[model samples]
Target chain A: MEQRRKERIDRGVKVRSDSIYALMSWRELSYLTVPRLLLIIGMLILPLVVTSMYWQRVISIVCIYALLALSFDFLAHYTGLVSLGGAFFIGVGGYLTAIFNTTFGLPPLVSIPLATVFGAIICTVLLLPCLPLRGVYFAIVTLMYPLVFARIIEAMDILGGTDGIMGIDSFSNRWIEQYLVIIVVLLLLFGLRRLVNLDLGLIFRAVKDNDQAVRASGMSITNYKALAVLIASGMGCLGGACIVHIYMWTGLSLFALDFSILPIAATVIGGAGTLVGPVLGCLILVPISELLREFGTLRIVFYSIILVGFIVFRSEGIMVYGQRKYHQFERWIKV
Target chain B: MNKEPILQVRDVTKAFGGILALNRVSFDLYEGDILGIIGPNGSGKTTLVNSITGFIKLTSGKVMFRGKDITGRPAHKIADMGITRTFQIMRPYYSMLAYKNLVIPLFSPRAKRTGGWRGGGKLGDRDTVSIDILEEIGFERDSYVPYKLASTLPTGYLKRLELARCLALKPEMILCDEVFSGLSMSEIASMIPLIERLQMSGITLIMIEHRLRELFKVANRVMVLNFGEKLIEGLPEEVIADARVKEAYFGSEEAKEVMDHA
Candidate 1:
């Protein structure tokens, strides 16, 4: 009996454009550039494109979640740091922005940037002791931070206690607020993409592959891990700082587990390692979440169903699947 | 061919909770020597390599590499000092391509300071240099095998990859763990020349093996280990001829079976 199987290979255009000589033909150049240019253009025009004030605010929230997912992707896929500290980063950044604005009488513009840098330093130094750990130990420590911080703030009542800080200044106006975050997210997404292609990225990947081997190569893995954590925490903090201004309030609610769990779900649904995949995942997820808000509390049940379907059927996630489809072609061949 | 001794292990002892793995083992490896370590299963041949290369912390002893006491230095630190080892079970960066697997070691600081596997495979042109090293170590030049994922390579290439990884460091001494055990006779035969070339190029070696016949062919001197103690160290002929080596390692009946095949 004769048998047949589907053979897959890279498309001619994909192979041609992926090389250094992509400039040789206009078609090959576009084949490579079009998809990326589309993502940039689509994101740039999104606020203007959405038209509804309600959904436009949703767009801002989507970007916030996208930033969080990007942090998760960069650390988990590139450096092998599985961080559950998304809420911790947001909480720290939010409170810092709140303190800077309320305590120092700083405006939104100065406060946000200050919070991002200072919050990342606070997170990095705190997490430095756990740098030697990997896998579940690291995950547990990161997960513990937000919960512990939330309880401490609630119990001690230092930074406004349960009621939290209020009257944090909003961005000067709505347009400034929306575009400010959209542009920063795009800048960070591309910046991280470029950074991962550098020599430092090579060491980060090597540490992920084998920490002992990376050490054998005469590198200090702790320094690289710390650097990666700092970058990721900064991204998460930026999102958190933006959130405080968007809501005009900063509270213990910033440390909610939704911020922790949702970004990971977006990363898994978008694609684990690809920097842009989580952003795309956030774009799809946040809207679906807003629509499912009609179902009230049952939105979680529906959300879990969608997440489970994505995990069970296409566990590689949408971006990996999408990238594979774009680059390769399959055909049935007789053996 | 005698040169200065490059490494010295003195009174090294390792206890794993209760069991003794290496019992006051002492040896010195001169430059340009191929030292074969042979023993039955669980005689601690691999443990000796691990201890000397700093993969495991020593309970007691000194590992003097190039006149410096380097006992309990981390594995990477040892590799940085130009001592590297290949795993018995093989630990290639399974996610990377076969040639790319060479890139990590080639990018290592030691590999950068000293040249990597000759013929100009340095930092700037690493991808090409890695393939050059791979081709030299028996991976077919310009074939899909070198470009293929390390996980997909056949056992022969994987074994050669283990050596290629060590060679990327341009290591002063390489601790090779059972490189020929899983190979076919012809595969082992082809690997011998590559081993000879590495030795000829001035890399010292400590080879751990169960395939005694193939190992005895290249090893200048052989050390027999029995239950974590050095039973004898001599030329391959003397070590192979010793009666106690037969009883302790090969056993009376298994020694006769080894002879029947020879």
Candidate 2:
């Protein structure tokens, strides 16, 4: 009797280029850099290639969602914190930036950075008490924040109230608006990629694995959790700040659950921990969402079907699957 | 044998609601002896370890290490004081490489302060030190076993990795919770020498095991617990010969049959 099995092994180029010193030839170097270059080049030319003004706006939206997705993935995968406060971060940054630009008379450039920093600090401080909670408890607390903030704004009739803040300044020009977000997305995507590989990143992952074991190693889990939340919230707030300027309006819609949810969906579709996967997921998903707008209310049905199909078939995500294919080759062998 | 006890437990008790998981358990462990705790399932063996290591708060009791009262301290603080423990159901960082698993503890403040295993007054490169510790505990340094993910390692290696992690902390007293469970007979045979070597290195051990034959080979002292109460404590042979232990382990009818045959 003969038996056969399929085996997966790393490609010769992947193996040779595993270390920096072995990347002597251009082939191996390209094998390592080509995927990254494709992402960078592809993103850089997106505005030029889209041509449609409406679709160019969608690209900016994609970048905003990409930032949120990056935050969601980092907290969930690296720190074991499942945050559903994307809307909360967005609303805080959006409102703060709007107030700065409209009432405080600051420009978009000055206000966005200020709002991002201050918004993140506020989110982190509010979330500090919940840092000790893990899993669903932590998630539930985060989910409540946006809902609460939305209602408070509606009731108080402050920060533009129900009508929201209108007359907010747009970027100096269209190109600046598009490129600013795209570049920040690229920077954060790579910066986070580097962060998760550092010694601090090792500690963050250890906290995710087993907090008790991490505690047994004599490090404070709460401090690590708080730090992770601060970083994630900063990214989310930056997205919020950008989206406000793009719309030239800040209102209850800034705290919409869509902001919270779409990024999570994008993360699932892209891949959880790869850092770049969520951005790629945003690239794929945000455009599909726009294209489906023609179907009106029925868009949700098609959108859900696509999500379910991805979940059932390629749940490890596009980036994970693609990376596996890029690095390894499979063949049938007889035993 | 006359050395002062390094760890002292006096009336350590834990209560979960109305049930008494551990009821006033007390024992003294000397500096360099291997003490074996044996019991039927659900007899508070793990609870005892948890209570001592500060994983769970004690309802009422005292734990003294070197004459310092350490009752109800946090798990990490207890571990930093050189009392590390391995879980019953192996909880290695599954996402990390086997050697990288050791690297985490090697980066601990305690590891840095104690200079790690044979660290000789300075904790040098953690990655290299991690591989060295893995090699000492049977992870082949030259092979991919050390480089393989913790999730991919077999139970035998995972168990060794558990011990390897504790060693990376340079622990003084290690409470092992069923390290031999789920291991093959050959694996257990290989593990006996490693346990012996660990004991030879002057680290005290308290092993919780169900494999009585293998456990009796190494343990100088044995304690039996039945239904959260200590049945008896003595030399392994004496504890094995006791009527109460036999009755608790095998039931009265089986005990009679075995005793008559004996």
Candidate 3:
């Protein structure tokens, strides 16, 4: 009897590129660089390439969602903290940047950074109590934070309340705004890529694998978790700050669940662990969202269909699927 | 060997709502002794390991490690004090390579301070040290077995990886929760020498095992637990001879038949 089985093997170039031998050949080097280059170059030119003024604005919006998705992916996949606080972080950063620009008279440039840093610190401090809570508990607390902030703002009738903080500054020009966000996203995407390979990243991953075993290894899981939250929240807040400036306003809407929900959807469609996947997902999803605007409320139905289709069909996500195709080839071989 | 016991458990009790998972269990483990704990399913064997290693809180009890009361201390604190454990359901870092799994424990403060696995007062080159530990625990270095992902490894290798992780900490005492449960006869045969070698290195071990034949070979003393209570504690032969332990393990009818044959 004859039997055969399908086997998957890494491409010769991929194998070579995985090692020091990659430097010896331009083919191997290019194999390593091309996908990354495509991402960077593709993102860099997207603002100029999109001719429509409305769609250009959508690019900036996509970048903002990408940042949120990146943060969500990092915390959920790497740190095992399934956080739904994207809205909470965005709300904090948006409001803080608004106050800095509107009340303190800080420039858009200065306020964004200030809001990002302080908002992150605030988010981390607030989330500290819930750091010990694992899995869904951490998620529920995070989900509640934005709602609580929203209600508090609505109830207290403070910080412009329902009307929101208006007359806030936009970036000096469209180019600066577009490039600023796109560059920041690229830098963070690459920076985080490096970070997850570092010793601290090792600790984060270990904490995720089994906190009990990590504890058994004598490292405090709580400390590593706090550090991961700080990093993730910082990224989300940066996005929030940028969005506030882009919109020229900050308000209760900053705490909207769209910020929370969309990034997670982006993460799922793009791939959960791969930081770039979520960004790619936002690029695909946000534009489709904008395009679907003509359908009015029915856009949500189209949105759900697309999401459900992706979940059911290509659930491993586009990046993972793409990576596998790029790196390995499969063929039937005799057993 | 009249030295003071290194680990002392006094009247340890754990309850889940109205049910007592562990009822007033107390035992002393001395330096360089292999203590085997045997029981049938849900006999509180694993629960005892959990309580001592600080994996769970004790309802009312004292766990003293070398005269220091370590009761209710966090698991990390207990591990830092040189008491490490391996899970019965091996919890290897699935995404990491086999050697990388040990690197985490090797990076621990305790490993750095105490020096890991014959580290000779210097914890040097963690990657190399981790590979060395993996090789020592039967991972074939030449074949790149240590370089393979932990998730891909078979049960035999995963079991060894579990022990390798504990050794990376240079632990004074290791609470092994069923290290032999899933292994074959030849694998357990090979594991016996590794157990003896670990003992020879002066590290104490508390093994919870169902394989009584293999366990009796290594354990200096045996304790039997029945329904969350200590049924008996004695030498392996003495424990085997006890009618109560047989009944607890094999049930009354089967135990009587075995006893009658004996």
Cα lDDT tens digits for candidate 1, B201-249: 9999999999988888899999998888999999988987889998898
DockQ of all models, two decimals each? 0.43, 0.51, 0.65
B60-156 per-residue lDDT for model 3 (tens digits): 9999999999999999999999999999999999999888898889888999997798898699888899889988998888897888888999999
lDDT against true structure, model 1: 0.89
What is candidate 2's lDDT per residue for A1-335, written digit by digit as tens?
A: 89999999999888889898556999988988999999999899988898888989999999999999999999999999999999999999999999999999999999999999999899999999999899999999999999999999899987778999999999999999999999999999999999998777888898999887777665668878889999999999999999999999999998899988999899989988998899999999999999999999999999999999999999999999999999999999998
Worst 10 residues of 3 chain B by lDDT: B253-262
Q: Candidate 2 has which clashing residue pairs, if any?
A: none
Candidate topping lDDT:
3
lDDT of 1 by residue, A109-178 (tens): 9999999999999999999999998988999999999999999999999899999999889999888999
Q: Write the per-residue lDDT of candidate 3 for residues A1-335, one digit (tens) a residue.
A: 99999999989888788978889988989999999999999999998898888888999999999999999999999999999999999999999999999999999999999999999999999999999998999999999999999999999999998999999999999999999999999999999989998767888999998788899898888888999999999999999999999999888998999999999999999987999899999999999998899999999999999999999999999999999999899999999
Lowest lDDT 10-mer window, candidate 1 chain A? A211-220
The global C-alpha lDDT for each of the candidates, from Candidate 1 onward, is 0.89, 0.91, 0.92
In angstroms, the error of model 2 at A114 is 3.6
Tell me the deviation in Å of residue A213 in model 2: 3.4
